[model samples]
Target: MNILVAATSVAAVAFLLLSSNQNIPESVKPGSSAALFALGTAGFLVVSSVLALLRVKFSRWLMLAAALIFFGILGFQSLALLVSSGASLPAGATPKLWANVIRNTLEIAINAWALLSAKASTFFMGNRPNQSSEADGSAAAQL
Candidate 1:
C-alpha cells in the first residue's frame, strides 16, 4: 500500500511538472492558486509516503490525510471539467483532459480501497505485543 501511494504520488507530481510546459489544465495553470495548492498537496503526499515506507508512526496518519486530500482535489477538478464541458468529447475538451480524468479516478478508487482496508489499518497502527512489558514479566519471574 505504501509503495502504491509512493509511486502514484511521484507519478502525479512528475506529470504535473512535465505538463506545465504544454497544454496543462486550466485550474492548475502556473501561478494559479489551484496550482499552488496542488503542488503543496503533492509534496505532502510524497514526503508522507516516504516516511510511511520508513514505518514512522505519525507519518501513517499524515499519509492517509495527504492521500485523501490529493484524491479529493483531483476528483473535484475532473468532475468540474466534465460538468462544464457537458460531458461531451467534442465539446472543446482535449483528449488529454479525458485521459487525465480517467487516470485520476482510477487512482482515487484504488488508493481509497487499499487505505480503508483492515489490513492497511493494522499495518499503519501495528498489532505487535508490548516487548517491554514482556521483558518486565520475565525479569519478575526470575526474581
Candidate 2:
C-alpha cells in the first residue's frame, strides 16, 4: 500500500541524512559513540522498513516493531533537545534536531495508520496466487 511504502520512504530519508553526516552534531566527532549510534539506528530502521515491505506474513509485526523503536528514539531525542535548548549549541544543531523530530513523528504516525488499516492487514495476510498454490503443488504440476 502507498501508506506503508511512505513509511519506508521516510526511513530512506533518515538513512540518507545520517549517512551523509548531515544529522551528526558538530560536537560529536566521526566514529564517536553518539555518531555511531545514530548511524546504527538509521541502518536498523532502513533494514526493518525493507523487511516490512517484503510481503511476508510477518510483515505487520515487523512494521510494529519498527514503529515502536522509532517512537523510542523520538522520545529520547525530544528529551535531549529539551535539555540542550538552554545550552549554547551550534546553529545547525537545532534545525537538524527539529527536522528529525518532525520527520520521525510523521513516520510513526503513518506506520500506526497503516498497521491499523484493514487493507494493510489483508495485504500482509493474503497469499499470492503462486504462494497459495505452491503448498498444494498444483501450480507446479500445471507446468
Candidates' C-alpha lDDT:
0.67, 0.63
After superposition, candidate 2 runs with Cα above 4 Å error: 1-26, 30-32, 87-100, 128-130, 134-143
- lDDT (Cα, tens digit) per residue for candidate 1, span 16-76: 7567455677556345565566567877888887777666767767877887787667767
Tens-digit per-residue lDDT, 62-104, candidate 2: 6677666756586567758756774576767777776777777
TM-score of each: 0.57, 0.57
RMSD of each: 5.7, 6.1
Angstrom error of the Cα, residue 61, model 2: value is: 1.8
Task: TM-score for candidate 1, please give it.
Answer: 0.57
- The Cα error of candidate 1 at residue 38, in Å, is 2.2
